[model samples]
Target: MMYIRTNQLLKAVILLLFAVFLFLLHETGEIARFINPQYVHLSQIASILFLFLFFIQVPRMFTNSEDDLCGCGLWGCSHGEEGRFAMKHVISYGLISLPLMIGFLFPFKDFGAAEALKRGVQYQVSQREARDEASLEKNVQELLEQSALVLHRDNFVSSLRALMAYPTRFVGKPILLEGFIIEDCQDEKVTVITRFLVTHCVADSHAAGFILEHEDSLGGREEQWLQVMGVLDVKQHGGVLLPVIRVIEWEEIEPPANPYVYP
Candidate 1:
C-alpha cells in the first residue's frame, strides 16, 4: 500500500501555488503595479526557487517509515508521523498562504484621492525636510535648459521636487503634467494633481504632486484624471510656499493602466 505524507503533500501544494502566483503576476504585467520593475528579475528568481523546492518536496510525500529515517539510520532521527496533524503547523501554513490568497482574490486598483488623503497628500517638495539644496538646484537648472518640461511616471517625483524646491526659477516655464485631481477644501479654484510615489513597492507608496490654479471653478472634479499644460508659479497656502501651476490648457483623461510612479 502506498501512503502519502499529508504534511509533505501540503507543503508541495503550497510551494507549487506560490510559484504559479508569482509567474501569473509577471505574466499579466500586474507585478509592475506592486514593485519596481528593476527588481522583477529577483521575483522571477524566487519563483524558480519555489518550483525547485516543490520538485524536491514531491518525492518526500511518498516516503514510508523506513525512508523517513535519517542517513544515520537511527529511529530517534525519524520525522514525525505522516498523518498526524499539529496546530502549530496548521497556523504556520495558514500564515504563509494569507498573502497568496489576497493576491489572487483581489483585483489591483489605482490609489485614489481618498487613499492619498489617508497617506497625507504632499502638495509641494518643501513639505519634506532634509533636502540637498545644491543637488536640487543642479537638477532645476538642467530642467530649465530643456525646451519643454513634461512630467511622466519616470521623472514625476524628481521633476516635482526640483521645481518645487526652486519655484521662482521654473516660473513662466511652460510645463505639462498628468495626475488625478484632489480638491483643496480651503480654496475652491485650487486643486491638487496627485500621484503616488513608490520607492520599492506599493506598501511604501506616498502621495506627491502639484497644486493647480484655474480661473474657473474646479468643483465636482475630485479624484478625476487630468492632463494639464501650464506655466509654473508659486502660491502661499496654509503659511507655506508651494509650487503651483497656472493652467493654460487642461483636459479630463482616463486613468493610466499603471498609475504609480517608481523613484
Candidate 2:
C-alpha cells in the first residue's frame, strides 16, 4: 500500500478522511491505543504526515492554471483564464487549514487533562452504580433464599400503591405482576405494559413495565384481565429495578374498567 501510486487529489482526500476517522473512532473508544496520546506516538506522527501532505496539496489544488500545478494531479478540474479566481475558495482554505496546522504543531496538554478528568469522573460514577446495584441484588437474593415469599395479588396491589407514591423508586420493579391483556399487546406477548407510564407526560413517559410472555396474541381481549401472582424479583441498575419476572402461573380474568395508572 505504501508504494501504491496515487494522484495528489486522491492522496489529499485519503488524508482528510484519515483525520476524520481517527477523531470519530477515538470518540467511540474504538481507537483506544491510537488516541491514548502517550502510547500512540507513531500514530500521531502518521497523522502529522498526512496532515502535512493534505495542506501541501491544498494551495496547489486551488490554483487555476495547470502551469501553476508542478505535477499532473495537483488539483481538481478547473476553468481557464475566462473566469477570475474566487477569493472565497482560497480564504476558506486558509481559515480551515491554519488552525489545524497550529493545533498539530502545538497540541494543548491542559485541555487534555481536563478531558481526561471528565471521562474519569463519568467512569467512576458508572462503576459505583454498578457496584451498588450488585449489592442490592445480593440482598434481594438472600431475602429470597430465606423465607421471603413470591409476590401475590395482595402484595401486587400494595406494590402498585407504593409504585404510585414513589414512581421513580418502584415503577421499574420486576413484580410478579399479572393483569388482563385489557388490550392487545401492541408489540409482544398477550401482556399490556401496566407499568410503562411517564410522570411528566406520555411524551416523557417510558413504558417501563414487566413483559408477561403470553403466547396467544388475541387470547386476552379488551376488558379481560389476567391473574399474575408470582415472585417480583428486583434487578436494579442505578437504583432502577429492571423487570425480570419469574412467572408462576397466569389465568384469564375480567379487565378493570379503568386500566391506566394515573401518574
Candidate 3:
C-alpha cells in the first residue's frame, strides 16, 4: 500500500489555490479594486513563489516513514504527525483558508456611499502646507488656463485639490465631473458628488467630493451615478470654506468600471 501524507497534500493544494486566485484577479482586471497598480508586479511575484512552493511540497506527500525522520534522531518524528486531528491544527488551517474562500466566493464590490459615510466624506482639501510652492503654482496656473475643466481618474485628485485649495480663483469656471451622489444628513436639500481616493489599497481609501447645489430638487437621487456640468463656487460648511458645484446641466450616467481615484 502507498502511504500518502495528508497534511503535505493539503499544503500543496492550498498553495496552488492561492496562486490561481491571484492569477484570476489579474486576468479579470479585478485586482485594481483591491490594491494599487504600482504593486501589481509584486503580487505576480508572490503568486509565482506560491506555485514554486506547491511543487516543492509534492515530493513530501509521498515520503516514507524513514524519509520523514529528521537527522536529530528523536524517539518519534514530530514532522509527519499532521494527519492526527487537533483543535489547534484545525483552527490554523481554517484561518489560513479564510481569505482564499472569500476571494473565490464573493464578488468584488466598488466602494459606495455607505462606505463613504462610514469613513466620513472629506469636503475640503487638506490644510497641509505645500512642499513645493513653485510646482503647486505651476499646476494651478495650468488649470486656470483651461477654459473648462474636465475631471478624469488620472487627474481627479490633483485637479480637485487645486480647485479646492484656491476656490476663489476657480469661481464661476465651468467644470464637468462624474461620481456617485450622496446626501448629507445635516442638510437634506444639498447632495455631495463623491469619489473614493485610494493611496495603496481599498482599506486605505478615503472619500473626496464637492457639495452640489441645484435649482431643481436633488433629493431622491442618492447613490445614483451622474455626470454634472456646473460652475464652481465656494460655500461655508461647518465653519470651513469648501468648494461647491452649482449644477447647470446634469444627466444620469452608469457607474465607471474603475471607480476609485489613485493618488
Candidate 2 lDDT over 124-191, as tens digits, reads 11343345555445544443353433344334333333332233443234344444333322332233
lDDT of 1: 0.81
Please list the residue runs of candidate 2 whose C-alpha ends up more than 4 Å from where it truly belongs after superposition: 1-175, 180-193, 201-203, 213-223, 230-248, 252-263
Highest TM-score, which number?
3
Q: What order do candidates take by lDDT, descending?
A: 3, 1, 2
Clashes of each: 0, 9, 0
Task: Estimate the TM-score of every prediction.
Answer: 0.88, 0.26, 0.91
Clashing pairs in 1: none
Instruction: Give lDDT: candidate 3, residue 72.
Output: 16
- On a 0 to 100 scale, what is the lDDT of residue 261 in model 1? 91
Best by lDDT: 3
Alpha-carbon RMSD of each model: 3.3, 18.9, 3.0
**lDDT winner between candidates 1 and 3:** 3
Q: lDDT tens string, model 3, 79-149? A: 63555757877798899999999889988788998998888888766656255556567778999999999
